[model samples]
Target: MSYPDLLSFAAGLLVTGALSGVLAGLLGIGGGGIIVPALALALAAMGYGGDVGQHVAVATSLAIIIPIGLSSARAHDAKGALDRPTFRLWAPVIFVATLAGGISAGLFPGKVLQAVLGFMAFFIAANILLPFLERLMRRVHGSATAQRLCAAVIGYLCALMGTGGGALSVPTLAAFGLPIHTAVGTGAALGVPIALAGTLGFLISGWNAEGLPPLSLGYINLPALVLIGGVASLTAPFGARLAHRLPARTLKKVFAVFLVVVGVSMLWAAFG
Candidate 1:
């Protein structure tokens, strides 16, 4: 990249990191919903291949989620909100699913990936915007088999979309009778395995692919990954602190609007 291009990329990452941190804390989201598309736009604009760019963004976003998920999970755990038993039961299947999803991501075309992410984003936003729809979502229960199935599905889907598990996990957990706080905490914790397994899969899948940018390790962009992950992790605590004082509902509504924009934009990029 040229000096100017590098500057632009850094600036974009800075903004993305800052916003992701605040949203993670303020909304109980893992922030991948915000990060993935933002990275996709930046990479594409920097002249990465149309398809490769989005895939890299997705993989890199998943990689970056490691820190944010860990931090958020720790905070929630400290608050006694994370459901450990649920996480324990769900982890193994999620590991397998994320691995499979990561591998499968390479088989699909860019358009397919974008369509998948766009639809997932739309669903996420809808759940937030329309409480009734969220309420209508199926709820699981104390059954180990049900939790395992839910985790496997969430892990697979999130891997494909480059999201942390929060978007899917929280609602599913809530449906299973976990409190919102507990669900969010559990979701954050679950993201660790999902991200790790998916990251490894993407790394292997993208290793020999053509048209990757400089400093890329497979699908992961090292510069962006390091900068965004570091910055977002640093800022998450501040966001958590702010959450104690700020109006969560207002923040979440704002996030929902942003999510809608992301979904619509990705769909346009994919099909338009």
Candidate 2:
């Protein structure tokens, strides 16, 4: 890339990163909700090849989230909301499931992956909006086993969607009876494993994807990583602080509404 091109890329990346960072901090999400679609659109705008641009965008979004997850996790840990024992217990399963999901995405066609994303969005939205569903699951018995099962399912789905797993993990944990604050905080920590496994999987799977864009690191867009990761890291502490002060019940409901909208948008985009 030329100097002018580099400058322009940096400018765009900074803007993307700034917005992603604020959202990550505010919501305890790794900002994949924004990153995936935005990066896809940005890559296309940068003249990346039509065939592989979306794939690269998805992979790159996961790659960038690694650091963002770490930053958010650390901040949450400091706030005393992270459940170390639970994280330790479930990390291995989440790691493995996420890796599997990443591999599946890499091996699948773009259209298939898009459909998977759409379906995942719908499922996650349902999880958010339907407290009764969780209560029903609990009533079915084996609640402990059910929680682990839900976690595993979320891990796999997050991997497929190129997310940090916060969107599903947080709500699932909360539904399982953990405090909402604890769920969100621990969810941040959980994102680390998901991102680590998912990023590596993407790297391995996309190592030779045809027609890769310039300056790409396997499937990752380096400029986006630098910008988004950097800003998110810096702003996460603020988010942690806000999480403590806010009324968690209200915040959760508001977030659930947001998820529904996002889910519908993804569905429309996929099938429109």
Candidate 3:
């Protein structure tokens, strides 16, 4: 990239990172729902091919989530809210499934990945916007084996979508009869394994792919990761503080609208 283009890219990353961090903190959701689609669009604008750009975007989002996930987990742990037994039961399967999903992601068509991201976003949005949908979502609370299976599915799908798994895991935990706070805390801890394993898998899978962007390590874009991660970490505390001052229901509605817009755009891009 030319110097001017490099400047533009860095600027975009900074903006994206700041927005992601704020939304994550304010909404108490993983940033990947925002990060993956934003980066994919930005990369496409920069002339990267659809499949390669989406792969890079997903991988980079996972990489960026590592530190943030760790920090959130620590915060939740400090509050004594993390469900250790649940984590111990679910982490191993989640890690394995996420790793496998990340590795296999490169083999899928770009449009498929795009559609997955879009659908997941819409699903989350519906859960938030239409309270009735929550009543309809199947509640799976059975044997330990069944819970682990839920974790595995959450991990795999999160890897494919470049999420930290909180969006899916928290609700699953709730379905398992945990309180909302405990579910959120446990979900934060679970994100750690998903991000770490997903990053490693993507790195290995894309190590030899052709036409990667400059400053890339496999599918992960190093510059984007560093820029976004650093800025996000710095901005998140501010967002968290603001979250306490806002009406959470109002915030959820606004965020749900944003997700709907993003979801529609992604699906359009995929099939357009």
Candidate 4:
């Protein structure tokens, strides 16, 4: 790369990394929604070609999310909020389901993958906004059984959406009468499995694709991964601190609204 191109890449990396870090911190997500799209645009702008650009972007974003999730999980653990017993119960189910989802993504066509992402964003937004769903679940709740079921569902959805699982898992747990702090902390832990499984699938599936951009690792773009992952790791603990200090009610409402807007935007991107 020329000096001018290198400079541009550096600028792009910083901007993307900063934006992703802020979103990850504020929302308790691994910033996959923002990172994947930004990466696709950045790669295209940098003159990467072929029909595989978006796939590479998504895969690379997942690869970066592995470390981001680990960092966030650690922060949550420090707060004594993670549900270790519950996590142990659900981890195996989530691992299997996430692997299945990843394989599906890898085997599916590009248009189909895009449509799935669009639909998932909408579904996730609905889950965020509907407090009544939690009430309904609570009406039928039993000891441990309900929580296990919820975890399984959350794991499946998280894999399908290409998220760290916290996007849906945290809220689901909160709805089940788990304190918001515990839910968020436990949800963060789930991200580690999701990222690991999802990244592996992307790498395996994209291994044979040609015309990949420089610094590529299978579908992952190494430069973006390093930049986004590093900054997000640094900022996640701060976000955890903020989560502890802020009122859960306020954060929940704010996060729901944000999900709605982001969902709409993603749908627009997919169909428009």
**Per-structure clash totals for the candidates:** 0, 0, 0, 0
Candidate 3: tens digits of C-alpha lDDT, residues 1-272? 68998798789889988887765554445578778888888888788867899999999999988866766666656666689999999999999999999999899878888898788778877876675434544444557988888888988898888988877776667667766566666776788899999999999999999888888999999988999888876665455555545564665576578668768977987898
Candidate 1: tens digits of C-alpha lDDT, residues 9-76: 89989889988876666555667877887888888788885889889988998899889878877777
State which candidate, 2 or 3, has the greater TM-score: 2
- What C-alpha lDDT do the candidate models reach, one value each? 0.80, 0.73, 0.79, 0.70
Q: Each candidate's root-mean-square deviation in Å? A: 2.3, 2.4, 2.5, 2.5
* TM-scores of the models, in the order given: 0.90, 0.89, 0.88, 0.88
Better of 1 and 4 by lDDT: 1
For candidate 4, report its TM-score.
Answer: 0.88
Query: Which prediction has the highest TM-score against the true structure?
Result: 1
lDDT of 4 by residue, 30-146 (tens): 767777666766777777733477677767777777777777778878889788976787677777677666655656554454556667666666776767668777776555776
Tell me the TM-score of model 3.
0.88
For candidate 2, give the lDDT: 0.73
| TM-score of model 2 (CA atoms) | 0.89
Per-residue alpha-carbon lDDT of model 2 for 1-272, expressed as tens digits? 57897787677777766666555555666777777766766777777734377677677777777777787778778878888877876688888888887777776666555566667666766776677656766673445566667767877877667777888887777766668888888888888888888888777877887788776766776767778678767766776777778897776875676566656655665677
- Model 2 regions more than 4 Å off: 1-8, 49-51, 140-144
Q: Name the top lDDT candidate.
A: 1
